[model samples]
Target: MPQKMVEKIEEIAEGSDDGLCDVIFHLKSQDLTLTHVVNAGGVAFRNRSLVTSATELLPPSLEVLRERQPRTIRRKTDRDAEEPSFASTIARAPISASPLEETIARNYDRLATAIASAALRPSVERVKDRTKDRFRQYRPAVLWSSESLRVALRRDDLLDLRQRTDFLASLNDVYPNQQVGVPRYFSPARSSAKVQGELSRVAWGVERVGAPAAWGAFGHRGAGVRVAVLDTGVDASHPDLKGKIKGWAEFDGSGAQLPRSRPHDTDRHGTHVCGTIAGGGHSGQFVGVAPEAEIYAGLVLNGRKGGTVAQILAGLDWAIEQRVHVINLSLGGRTLERVVRSPFHRSLFHAASIGISVVAAAGNDGSQTSGTPGNDFFALAVGAVDVKDRCAGFSGGGTHLITESEHIGPKLLPLAYSKPDLCAPGVDIRSTVPKEAWGFLSGTSMATPHVAGAVALLRSACQGFSDLPGFRQSSVIQDIILATTFDLGERGLDHRFGFGRVDALRAIDAASGWVTDTSEYRDRRNRSPVAPPSARGRLGRLPGIGPADPGA
Candidate 1:
């Protein structure tokens, strides 16, 4: 190609249109390297299949996000080494303060608490309560005591960030007993490697998680309950995934639905994850964890062109609106982002509080690595396990824990579980692809759907589960899922195995009374990681994701 054409191509490729870099690179066995990337929550444009961020249904803040503004704009030297961290603030009504109080919560019952504490506070900036009006739609769902509140804020300028940081410094002295919120982000948890498995017997991943047993032995196949797969859009026309799609939609950066879900699957991530969750086994070559379950598919990622955090939050918000019983997020970005933001985390907690079980893939960033929403407190993070039940090399975990999650599980998990909530089959997993094809993929992404499908089956087996009190249904479901796991890795909740490999059969059996100890599933609200005394404004080195550049 001529030099002018090459420069023109570079310009267009580097320029993002509506959140997509739209790079068209031609490598005739000569080209070398390239790059670029992008997350979901919400229901706007009630009837329209797709809506933009500025759509009337979206909150004011989402409009800003839809523009895909830079994630942070700081001087090169000022930027800290990016590390993934985000804070989710879950609150109810305020309690009487005393020496006995271990932490302080922002607001008792208002959606504005998270924003005000971080940026709207009088001490932080002159912005004051003005910022809260922009994000009232992002409030938490309260079940037992009061509503939950989780918020995310943007620093429009150096002065804005300066005020926020200065306030963070005195957080210890300001509210000695309260927990400050953490900023959060969302990324895709890339896929796994392809390996050979028995084409005849049940798909190894399905068998490994005992999906067949949940079907044949108990006659449970995730009926009634609905599960959502938030990833690259699914190939709705695939034979196995045909009628399984109860509802599906695509979203742009700002959480608005797409015009309509495409029958094509340029990105097979969502299709494969859906197949693992509830493929109809049209080819008889692959089986899903919950074949009879209803599916709610969201195309958060746009094929190879990466998506943005706004896109993800919108999908999540929509799934909650759709009242999905379980949601599986098989995508994520780096586990090393500097500032850990948790608007995504708070949304997950809000979804869970409303009885929606969320499962996310631990990123592929290997051991001791963690990232965005997956590392958030509320998301049930799943790690990848090969057919041999060994943790996948790319599974991300082992850094820090959400203070709230530290007290979850039937038993107290070891601190190593700062990342992974558990493990499931992800290696060499065979499932439906686009154009009626079947393919094998591996990653924590694949492992996530297994758990999500399991959640559906357990919900199907349990009667009157929905009638349970707020947080009770999700808590019981979580308990059954965690306690039934077959132990592995370090004899306890190691970074890799978390609560150990998932046992779908055991979970359903205990949940449906095939086994005893139904009481083990009770909700234990012991630890409050949110609004805790020492929780700081979870800050990190903001990278190119912010203002200076619309993250490449």
Candidate 2:
């Protein structure tokens, strides 16, 4: 009786050359009929009646074809003689039940009919409504500079305020430094012989000494390690990073920079971070943390060092989908949001929950405020420490802070924590930049990825460790890194240096459980000799062993 129902039946009939439609139509009168018509492509034939009934037909007119049967049949005997004829079949016979059951069943049948009709009609209205609802619920908060806003507004006038450039520019433009810098030591073309020589002589930190030193120590070089750098996009075609760079996703809808086009670094921050983590050795020039580790680059921020929460979220989601083992987020923002509640935080937590370690910069604000992604417990929040192994003056201090209605107690606020978890050579550190251009910049941003690169080395050394069941169930990697640090600041676990300066060589030695101890003893002749313990265990414990079990 409904207009939509009629249209659906007509469509089905047209598709079948006026043969009985797959769906059955039942009216209050309980009458049924089967009509047939013939057509030759564009040539049409008048409708011809095959069978008509005054009462409900015996098979109820809803028939499904057998596998071998042609979809359309011209003769009735051809269908009736087939295996399991519809006439002998019995479908859902009316059941004598309670009124409620009858009503429910009737409604369900009606709903199914409506669904089938709408699907066949192919209306875009419902899809449009869903799209609008999604936009309303997840509208991203944009943060851009005034110049960017003007460009965006001029580009599209129909966009709503939330999508408009003027509105995004009005928000706080907190993040600056968006360019990648080239170190003064870097040159585009250094001889391969020189590069290999530097690689052999470079004083890798204690932790990194083993993997590069031993062949097949774990797996073959660069077999399964995956390091994803989520920052500015990478130069896919860079000669040094050709096949080594894998997987890419773009969230920036604007057609400014693409995968093939390497955007000029406005601040050199991302390139520096990338170089530190996995810069390929070019000629005899700069090398990265894990030179052989496979690198995946994602550009979340634009050239201006500004992006919406949505773009960042998209980048994170893409990274997780790639199943990267290590994610380095060398950026931060001030927020006390929980990963469980915020979508952005939730995305990061999801990645970590699946065994991917996320590392983030504490912040450069020089306040006690921990930034958003860094504040997430799922991430390893790294703070800056100077060359003297003292907390950098610009590093944030941690103290008790209030958050929401819940009186969350004291914890190390990321940037403001009195003592950083560990210190690294943050001042005058060198790394990579875009346009083959490199420079040096200072901030906690430069320090975070150092730990990420260290993790990559550990991952390489402990082949198949991540794949083992419950490998990351404990804080093995975290404790090993802390125990290997060389004390530099005030005392043990002071505010300036949480533990001590990161010693890569020491860390590698610790991983192997090797230690060398020196102790002074008085002899019978009133003579004393200082005998240092070998790089082995002492006092019934391993040399690298600390108060707490590193593997535990």
Candidate 3:
């Protein structure tokens, strides 16, 4: 590569958004390495010549180098950085002098920024188009109305008509007379038997708190709670999951129609997650976190293995309108600066205000970092822990929470402070398979649904508490789960385990007003101790068995 050509390539790449460019040059030297960044538009590259392959290595190949380029630029003048004086002024005003009023004002300002950004971004439109397309193909039974149909339907006999064969036939071109089963799933006899066995054993009872044991003990079995699994579309017809799936929306630009059952396991990841959250245990094989919770499957990620932030937001918005009680997000990526002004986060906040609990998996990057939306405080960010209750090697950590200002610009960047609110079993967990089979997988993606299911259990058990008049509503359901976790990572709440490992039985007990002592809890990651013989046996029996036993 010539010096002049190198400088020219560098200039073009630097000037492009995200320091990327698409151009090819025949280098005079074979020792030069070419690096390129490629996107939908095309590819860009940079090359560096070296005396030997080992010295600096040839620049990446033109193809490889082009694929690495940034798709967009981060500018100081980016709209997200500008302060909203009017909204800020209104927010800071001493209106009513009440805490609630102040909170509302602050939220209003945040909402304003989010809305503005949504209006300006073309990504939002693309996401909407994709979502609408998917719905048109599968689950076409779902009607889209420009007006408030839920309200209008409430005043008419539309819901009643939905139960009528002729009306359904008129509305849907396929299987008009087919009856849709109730979304929730449960087995009183089976649950009672499992709960009794756990209660009879001390260690088992203690370890599985807020889990199936707790779920079985209380009759609040996720009766009315609706959970939105935002990932690949679910196998709505899987025998174990058939009636348990209530609704679905595809944001993959294919148009929504009846969910396909054949290629249910295309990704396999989402199906496994769905099983973990609501699998009916029909084969006496696997049971979900909240067996009776209604599930609304949203396919945000496509078969191609990746998706954008916009697609995720569209799924979230639809979930909110459906009044889903809990949202389980198991996918994430690097944080973008514009995310703070994202309508997606604002919608999540709106859902939170209305009692929706959002649970997301921290990235599997194996560092003290978090991805957007998951990084958002309103969403309960979860990390991965092994069966032995040790932090998974790939789980991300948190050092400090990023503020809105830091997330916006200038100094706006992801902070490496304390993160990952809590950890759960993320390594080698087995769950439902798309084609009526079962498989094991790993990642924080597997960890998130654990919390989602736990939330469903809490929702079921806390019906009375939530119904209580003026109970102070001090925290969201995510907070309750975090506060009740068994603190095990460090002196207090640190990055490894934000609050601590999730104990289903304990969380449920806490919801019912039963508190426990946490002084004896230890961080297995830092401690030099051996598990008791009995504990070792129990650990060995855990679902997923990894090669390296950290506890050992």
Model 2 lDDT tens row, 1-552:
233333433444444422212221211211010011001100110000111110111111112211122233334354232212111111111111223234335534543443334232222233234346543322222211011110111101111222333323322221211122221111223324422333332312212222233222322234466878777666644444546676665555321224464433334566677666666556333335566777777777665545544456556655766778878777655543222122233345345434577777655555455555665534556667653354767664343221321112122111122224555545445555666644455676777767777677766655434432211211234544555555555544443444555544344443433111111110111221111233222312322212211111
Stretches of candidate 1 above 4 Å error?
1-201, 260-263, 337-340, 401-417, 514-552
TM-score of each model, paired residue for residue? 0.60, 0.51, 0.55
Q: Tens-digit lDDT track for model 1 on 283-319?
A: 6654688888988888777776656555676677678
Please list the residue runs of candidate 2 whose C-alpha ends up more than 4 Å from where it truly belongs after superposition.
Answer: 1-223, 237-242, 253-267, 335-344, 400-420, 470-474, 490-496, 513-552
Relative to the true structure, how large is the alpha-carbon lDDT of every model? 0.54, 0.41, 0.48
Tens-digit per-residue lDDT, 1-552, candidate 3: 123333443454444442112121111111100000011001100111101111111111122222332223234353311211111111111222223234345534443343234221232334335456542322211111110000111111222332344222211111111111111111122323333343222212123334544533454557787999888667776766778888777664322232453334346667777877877546654347777789988877774555434456557767866868788988766443422322234445445544577888877766766665566644678887765577877777654433333113333334223457677767656567677765556678878888888888887777643531111121224435654566666644566766677766555554453212222222221232222234333443534321212222
How accurate locally is residue 141 in candidate 1, as Cα lDDT from 0 to 100? 21
Over the full model, what C-alpha lDDT does candidate 3 score relative to the true structure?
0.48
Please give the lDDT score at residue 449 for candidate 3: 84
